[model samples]
Target: MTNKLKLYFKAAQSAKIGIWEINLETNLIYWDSVTRCIHEVSEEFIPTTKNTIDFYSIDKNRDEIELLIERAIVEGTPFNKTFQITTAKNNIKYVEGICQIEFLNKKPIRLLGTFQDITKEQNLINELQQSVEKFSSIFSSANDAIFIIDISNGIITNCNPRASELTEYDNSELVGIHNSELFPVKYRKEVRVFLKSHLTKDNYIVNETYIKTKSGLTIPVEVASGKKFKVGDQTFSVCFFRDISERRNVEENMNMLSLAASETTDTIVIANPKGKAVWANNAYLKLTGFNLQEILGEKAGYLSKGPETDKRTTDKIRKAIQDKQSIKVTILNYNKQKEKYWFELNITPIFDNNNNCINFVGVGRDVTARKEKEFELRGLLEVTSHQNNKLFNFAHIVSHNIRSHASNLSMVVDVIENTENTAEKLSYFELFKEGTEKLSETIEYLNEIITIQKNTNIEKKEIRLKDEIEKTKYALSLSIKESQISIIDTIPEDLTVCVIPAYLDSILLNLFTNAIKYRHPERKAILKIGYEIDESYTIITFKDNGLGIDLEKNGHKIFGMYKTFHGNDDARGIGLFITKNQLEAMDGKIEVESKVGMGSIFKIYLNEK
Candidate 1:
């Protein structure tokens, strides 16, 4: 190659582009050294017109490039095209060429063009275009309201269809409006402060606030705002907003329902199917002495009967809950202090949407007084029946014993009148006298029982518990010392009892004497007396470690008159019967827990003054 041609090739290589030209008349082609290099061809190779045309990519592109070249040559037109070309190594390369028709004497004869390798630039442009198209599609089709605002002027430059619908404005009306205008007047300052803080810190802001519609009504909106930049060196703020009015309304309704539930009078408790408490009203807390935090997720059976309650009643309650049915029953429940009281539970099963049992809703009311009244009436009837039976038996005994004595006396008188034997008459008179004494003793015992029955109407007054215990101890000081019995009076001095003073004394005396009389043979007698004051009742317990009765065998007859446990000559069994009557007269109660060879505890619950 000549030096000029070599310099020209070096210049084209330095430019990183190829140079090519076509001769229209002979259909010949010329390629520069850089062009040969781009096609992976030798510098000495002769490029034929057909071979060069074949270098263009096959199919429509090759045909199109040929037509463009022919048109430029024949009509003196310029042509520019970007098309793929196949090199000598069969590798595809992208090239952009600009061609100008060269004219000689007003007739197109030659074509001059410069071709450049732009594969990298074209690929980058294609990828960027795809990304822009994807983002544009997402921005227009998103369900949530979207807005692009000019940060400097606070003007909304663009908005989605959802944004227009949410603000109750058309696209034209919202495009140039200030973002603060979309918010209520009260929230404008807050919005400004938020924007300022977000811009200063370059942080994203997400919050719930009220927005004003075109009709001036406020609607709840959740907004997410952040900064964005466009290709034109324009900075904008992007906001995503969603309506939350329905969610807020639902929360308000739930709060209202909770408030109403709290104000109810009946004790209401809701438990899941697993028997864990889920919700408990205020009345329930007050009735059960449990707070919401203490009872939530706790088993409902925690409120069941304690040691003093009847097992049968508790069993019935469990069965009712298991059956998922409404139950109205009275049960004895212990309060926080372990004091027993009666309550009427009305339990109903609550079902879920599937019509399956989901929970139990129980409403309860304290019925201690009503239960006490019922027990009192039953006791009265039992007492009347016992009295009637005793009277019938007494009549029969009275007739037999009195008539036998009287007949003997009458016979003695007859014999004294008929016979003159002084010694025999005196002996007969002595026998008659003995019989009359026996009858008088029988009549006295009957009168004592009648007196006890008549004293049921004795008036009651407030009496200090400690004073009564002291006085009773003083009265039995000798017996207590002789028996070596230890009396532990744990009862508080402040505790008082509402009872008939005389009856209180009589009841305590009987209990004390019995404890001493029934002292166990194996050990020294230990007596414990204590009292507890509850909301509506005062309970006094008298416990003794003495000869405890066999409650399993003799529990029912322990309080019956003439029933005796020990074979002692003084075991008349009338003391407890009379003591129970006295306590009953004052609307009080007595309960006993005992085990053979173990011990005995007597609990007396009375009304609080």
Candidate 2:
């Protein structure tokens, strides 16, 4: 190869340009090194006239190229066009093809073409076109009226469809109009000077103004914001205008109260300095279900006070009136028909020129629904708290009480199995049966307690307190014997307490077990059970000579879950917590008094106050 030819090929390769030829008579196709690389074909792959055209995409590009080749061969025509092709690697590319015919004796024999990869340039052009189309769509379809104004002269150079609709002007008329021409005559001068201030910087602060339509109707508008745009040396401002006519009407209505008297919905009353009713608004009359004649001369709140009204609240209002000062209170009141409602009242004092109190005004509204919902929410929270405590209590009962019963049954069964005599074995079998029955009863009672927790309500029965105590004593007879604890019951036989039977049983059992579990090692443990009747409660006391808890240190946490004092190995610390929750579930509570060495006196108050 010649040096000049090598230089020419190198230049072509640098520009990604390649050369190709098609010979018509010989049915041969030739591709240079750069051309073959552009087609992504292997070096050893031979090119034939039939297979060469297949490199062009199997779409319009392939058909168009075939047509161009035939024209060049028949009429010696030349063509320059861009074609899309799929390379041997199946990657799509765009190529620019410039071809002309090579003639032999005035007839076409071969066609020569330059193929250059133009994919990157074509992709860039496509992206730029898409960006332009996107911005054009946003400008035309914007919700707010858009204006492009000459910042120097304040002339509206361009506008959107929305701008024409807002100003009631055609697109051509709106384009060349000055910005001030769109505003009312009174505001035009101000609007003109305001627009002219955008000489160096765009002012984007929203300014409120009125726009004059074609028919001279003034509509409210806000020049929402603006951005600076530049084309060559000239600068323009892109402004957005929003119609605020509805908003203006709303603001005006809020500013002015119609007649300012009957417009308000809250009850209003004017009373004399002595707090006697003098005048009342229609809302007050409607709320109380009384006419003006019936309400006049009556004390301001006399009509609403009922049998259930709180005297403390009434006294508070009376003191406020006597002092001639303003007061706000939410008081329970009744309508004329005796229906209950919660009144949120605000009282104000009016004084004369001499500063002596002359009149009083009371503004109130029925907040019964809101107050009731608040009360209901409080009750729900309490119920949730109770259910949560019961969940803990249920787990303790399952682990401790059920295990105790199971242990008794296992011991009784082993005794029955090991006994040699038939009668003794029979007696042990009966004891075993009793233990099994007790275990089953414990499970049923636990299930009942859980069901009551879910229901949030429990039914009480009149049961003899002495009988419940005796039953608990019998259940814990073995523990009492092992601990050498003496039991003394002072509750009378006929004294009955209104309580849930299962809860009473559980409460008594927990007290009995606690006395045995925490018995003093030095002194003889004695559990003295006593009760007293009061006007509001049936107080029951369970005093035990046991390892008493330190009230100063552990008083607050004695009834808390998982809290143990005195550090006994078997002190699970769950009995007292469960006992407290069970009592609370039944509208009762437990209190304790104790010293470090002395015994603990647990007083169970078992009635509602």
Candidate 3:
């Protein structure tokens, strides 16, 4: 009874209608509380087999119930059925009866059964069936060709209406065809291998290949295929095919344009409508001294513009791009090393069929050499004019100086010829000889100047400044001692600079002589030699504490030939002039700083290694 009650409770949770038991041998019967409740009987009411059979409708329902019970009891078979029954209140209710027989010694002895209400379960099953039918309808109506293939045999098991339309075949004709028949002959084997390899794995694989239509025309397609599921012994894959002929055509045109741009000498850059670089070729990278990684996705102008860039040209370029017009301009551009170059740029806006700008293409050629040549020509013209004036003045000065010496000799000759006393005649003869010697010296100085001016080729070699300074000091030792001068050399022992050795020696010798010649009368002179170097030039400085010249009065004339500021007869005013010429011939320069009584400093700049 406890087990029977547990069974009744389990069935009640699932909306079971009733539970019953019958003894076949003695014709005894039992009914659980659920069976009594289904009949609407009182708790204490006794039940009999006759009244229970009478509860069912007195028609085919009653006969069926009697037959199902007899089959269970006599044949030991289980039976389950649902029928309408009238309760004690005369209300009809649908209830299920399930019966199983128990046998003792191979003969049926008792039967037990359970009845459950399945109305809700039946309603859910009906709704699910309807949803499946709706999903099938939608799948067939899709626009793109869809093919469902059996993975193992590569056969097309099913396909939608669009598949037939795309392949130009009837739906019934495409159903049993192998999937390989859809692909072009060249790719059929590859398609077969792909399907077989990936059929077991749950993955979506896509490929762009050709497909053959019904009329034997090949069409390019992009197919997305993957394993959909496995049912029983068959594995299935669903593939979606899209036409890509238009995309292929666009790619071909792009390839042709790229080829043309690459073969040209000029650098070509392609920018989007917003003026940002999207692509550049090898020529572009080579021209700008930059790599693709450095320039891509950057503003087109940023790669080549700097502080020296012309703002007017940049504004013009911006306006031209905004107006979708072509522009040609020559602009100064800087490379990675910050070296400037002139570039001639031609930018043209590319438009689509609708007349809307899609991109801006620029072609640039480096024109630095041509621009430099133009400037060089203008500079040469100015230099030629200055040189002509200098030559005219030089010739006049030479003539005047020679004529003055000639006139002196003439006066001396007259004196010697007219005089009667022997001693007086001898003095006049001596005067004549001195004038001739002065004239010869002047001619020699003029020849030396011409030689310096004409000789432009000077071979340069590394010379140690400290060694040269010591050598100059030794060469001028006698003069230095006579003037009572002190020498201090502060140049490094290894401080070497590239210069013409003879020119360097001559320059230093002149500086030493000048320092000694112009020594202060009150104190002994002090000469200091030092060397310094900067990025492009090596500087050697010669400083002296002596009777320094007044730079404000004679600075410009200090290096001029035959220009003298001193009252001494030995001051020929030629040493500094020759020194300046030597410095210039060796591609060097000299600067002087001097005060009236303090000292003079001459800085000689030479090209650094």
Top candidate when judged by TM-score against the true structure: 2
TM-score of 3: 0.36
Per-model tally of clashing residue pairs: 0, 0, 0
Give the lDDT of residue 313 in candidate 3: 96
How does each model score on lDDT? 0.77, 0.83, 0.77
- Give the Å shift of residue 110 in candidate 1: 2.7
In the range 1-609, model 2's lDDT, one tens digit per residue, is 799977977898888799888888897888888888889998888998667788887789999999988888888999999988989998988899989788889999888888999999988888999999998899899988999988767788998899988989998999887887888789987776666664445667678899999988899998865768789998888888999986687456434532464657999887888999977778888998988888889999899999988999999999999999999999999999998999999999987558988678898999999999999999999888877767776777788778767766776667677888999888666556666777787888878776776677666788888877876665665566668889998888899888877667667777888888888889999999888878878999999888888898999999988899988887778788878887887778899998777789999988843
At residue 15, candidate 2 shows an lDDT of: 86
lDDT of 3 by residue, 212-324 (tens): 98988788888888757788988788898887776687467667878988878898988888788877877888888998888888878687898899999999998898888
Residue pairs clashing, model 2: none
- RMSD (Å) per prediction: 19.4, 22.0, 19.0
Local error of candidate 1 at 555, Å?
55
Scored by Cα lDDT, where does model 2 land?
A: 0.83
Off by over 4 Å in 1: 1-8, 36-63, 85-92, 230-233, 253-609
Write out the backbone clash pairs for model 1.
none
Native-referenced Cα lDDT, model 3: 0.77
RMSD of 3: 19.0
